[model samples]
Target: MGDGDRRLTVNGSLRSVPANPPRSLLDVLRYDLGLTGTKYGCGEGRCGACTVLLDGVPVNACQIPVDEVGDRSITTVEGLASRGELNAVQQAFAELGAFQCGFCTPGMIVRATALLRDDPSPSETEIRAALNGNLCRCCGYPRIVRAVERASEIGRSGGGRP
Candidate 1:
């Protein structure tokens, strides 16, 4: 690593953080690395729209400093797919039309991905509780919950994996 350059693992690939890196991981992921799938909603940790997997845990990228990231692995929404196929959660969301405006879909999917990875069969209440921090203005919570349930089924069937 150079004076102002940092290195980290992103989407299973080793990458170099931009020189004079931006303050927040969100900015670096979007502007510096062109990983724009992580949305910028509230610019605060309150909104989970900037959620991403940092070391396999969902975090509000807007609140994580670039320096604090160090060499941790970061996975954006774009990283959920494999072999040109969407992951279980993403496919379930798409098949069920869980999103309305689509602005919060990426964050929701990223968070859901982590949830399913940790617990493949989360109950409806557990799903809601897990997604409490991620707000959807279009009132798509019903579809979102159903999609997660469907994703659990898919995951169990080995049709899709998170």
Candidate 2:
């Protein structure tokens, strides 16, 4: 709570970090707090690999400074799950084999999670548009889009308990 320290609510927990020597939220999450699920891709905000939820909205963590995060809950890929079970999007991704390299899976999952929250049943075009920012070098776009559709199905069926 002091000027020399910065506090953040991450994954439903309150954490403190040094305020001086400002760094991006990605660095704070990966290095400072040891929450490595949020990846670092293209330090600029172009790549969605560093996507995280800033108070329920998806954003590129690499573009956000830790000092500016003050009090907003940060939900990383690690935070998408509740209890010990995977969320609907995560379950669909795993069940449908949506990822190849898996490096971009975290961001894809996080972004898809937000998309599903807003639209429980997004069309193929909608899903593709939603995930357009997130890149998958393995060319897994088809599977990824299907996984989002599958997630919508799972959510509507109440099978995944999302």
Candidate 3:
């Protein structure tokens, strides 16, 4: 289907957005839908700042087209929380002070959320690997890693995945 004809579920809601077929999912999410939580760090997808979950797997929103996302469930950083409660990864980032300047935190948290969902008991190495696509200029990698680890623990302990 054409970009303007594409429809998908975003953050648990259905949205029919307009795009240019080549337009990135990042643009549709941010400009078309106003889900600005997903940042645009590296347009090349080298940075995870534009990360979002496509069917619960972390993918660079900057690399995917709106037409390619038809009928799939897309979860942006804005969807991570609900009803005024933060998700586990968000809480972990806050408790562990995982961000500086906070530009990359949203993508990091979204990626971490996927990691925890796939493996609620990932080791430090696994966490690092999962977050390899994301880059933080603030040099907050250490704390971000710890936050993922903590979020994993929280999930394992039946904390409702935050």
Candidate 4:
């Protein structure tokens, strides 16, 4: 609770990273905590490759300073699994081929997870709007949208894992 002592929960675990210079949450997650699934792209936060959940909402980790993390719970891509099994969204992404290079997969999955958590049955337009922030260079936009639709169905069948 003193200066430079900041604590936050990530992937269901608590982390106490330093806040002296206030490193980006992305750096804390990847460098300090060894969670590399959250990728680094367009450090400006426009690419959404460093997306993660902050208190159940999707955010660009690169845009958030570690000191600002405070006590919020951050969910990385690694936290998507439940009991060692892939969650509905993850499975949908895999089965539906939502990604090609896979570099942006983690962020896409995390953002989609948040979207599904908020609305399990989002329409195509809703899915597109939700994913507007995330970009994939492989041009797999259609597949990505299909994957979201599949995840929605799976979630409706009680297959989603927070």
The prediction achieving the highest lDDT against the true structure is 2
Better candidate number, 1 or 2, judged by lDDT: 2
Question: Whole-model lDDT, candidate 2?
Answer: 0.91
lDDT string, candidate 2, 23-115, tens digits: 999999999899998998798988799999999999999999887887889999998888889999999999999998898999999999999
Per-residue lDDT of candidate 1, residues 1-162 (tens digit): 667677878899988876573589999889888999999999978879999999999999999988898778899999889879999999999899999899889999999999999999999999999999998988889999999999999999999977
Model 3: runs farther than 4 Å from truth? Answer: 1-5, 19-21
Model 3, span 39-108: residue lDDT tens? 9997998999999999998999999977788778999989989987888898888888888899999999
The alpha-carbon deviation from the true structure for residue 111 of candidate 3, after best TM-score superposition, in angstroms, is 0.6
RMSD of 1: 1.3
Global lDDT for candidate 1? Answer: 0.90
Q: Candidate 2: list runs displaced more than 4 Å.
A: 1-3
For candidate 3, give the lDDT: 0.87
How do the residues 19-108 of candidate 4 rate in per-residue lDDT, one tens digit apiece?
Answer: 667689999899988999999999998999999999999999999988777788899999989788999989999888788899889999
Residue-level lDDT for 6 in candidate 2: 78
After best superposition, candidate 3 residue 145: deviation in angstroms?
Answer: 0.8
* Per-candidate TM-score against the hidden true structure: 0.95, 0.96, 0.93, 0.94
Q: Where does candidate 1 stray beyond 4 Å? A: 1-3, 19-22
Clashes, model 2? 0
TM-score of 1: 0.95
TM-score of 2: 0.96
- Model 3, poorest ten-residue lDDT window? 1-10
